[model samples]
Target: MTQSMATRATVTVAAELTDRCDRCGAAGKVKIGLAGGGELTFCGHHANRFADGIGTAAERVVVESGFGWKGAQPI
Candidate 1:
């Protein structure tokens, strides 16, 4: 089932994305906190493209405010 916005709020949402994308050195928009304890940050483009896979494995997701992320839902 899809998660509601309220439930999604549990994940950290930053005002601005300051990190560079791990895949490509672009402005990061999404941050995926791994279940095992690390994190991966991504730009909007890469994040959406890999959303499905990342969503399933992430522990917590932190997206830039106002940035629409395909993998915003909690697994």
Candidate 2:
């Protein structure tokens, strides 16, 4: 079965951002998927800043494991 256009777009953006982040020596995953399908990556600190942007730019942000802290759980 053929993939939908949105799926294809998301894949393409993910791949592109992943490569860019790697080339840039970024530590964490290249977060993609915000409003209008925008893609971007963030280091340990900036990840939080981009968190909202990621949610707004693409449909969903893809987070790479082994890059950032998950924070403590609430009691």
Candidate 3:
């Protein structure tokens, strides 16, 4: 993955994602665009579980409004 892609992310707030978690079949609270390519949606539990990695690996992240995703930076 390119450093530019990994570092450049469009962060947004959301209520729910378009689909379920990529890692697990649960409601998605955070949606992430990958640095390599593609996207991932994770439940609140998983989002917190992979916070540190997500912060570095995601190209973009959409977090629920008013909901804190450890990997997300406020916009």
Question: lDDT scores for all predictions?
Answer: 0.79, 0.42, 0.77
Candidate 1: deviation at residue 43, Å? 0.2
Candidates ranked by lDDT, best first? 1, 3, 2
- What's the best-to-worst order under TM-score? 1, 3, 2
- For model 2, which pairs clash? 33-58, 34-56, 34-57, 34-58, 35-56, 35-57, 35-58
Clash count (model 3, backbone only): 1
Candidate scoring better on TM-score of 1 and 2: 1
Which residue runs of candidate 1 sit more than 4 Å off their true CA positions?
1-10, 73-75
TM-score of 3: 0.75
Question: Which 10-residue window of candidate 2 scores lowest in summed lDDT?
Answer: 3-12
lDDT of 2 by residue, 1-75 (tens): 332222221322222334334234565455655566455655545554444344335565554554442221111
Candidate 1 vs candidate 2: which has greater lDDT? 1
Q: What is the lDDT of candidate 3?
A: 0.77
Model 2: lDDT of residue 57: 51
Candidate 3 lDDT for residue 30: 90
Per-residue CA lDDT of model 1 for 1-75, tens digit only, reads: 564333322367899988999999999999888878888999999988887767677878898999988666535
Candidate 1 TM-score, C-alpha based: 0.79
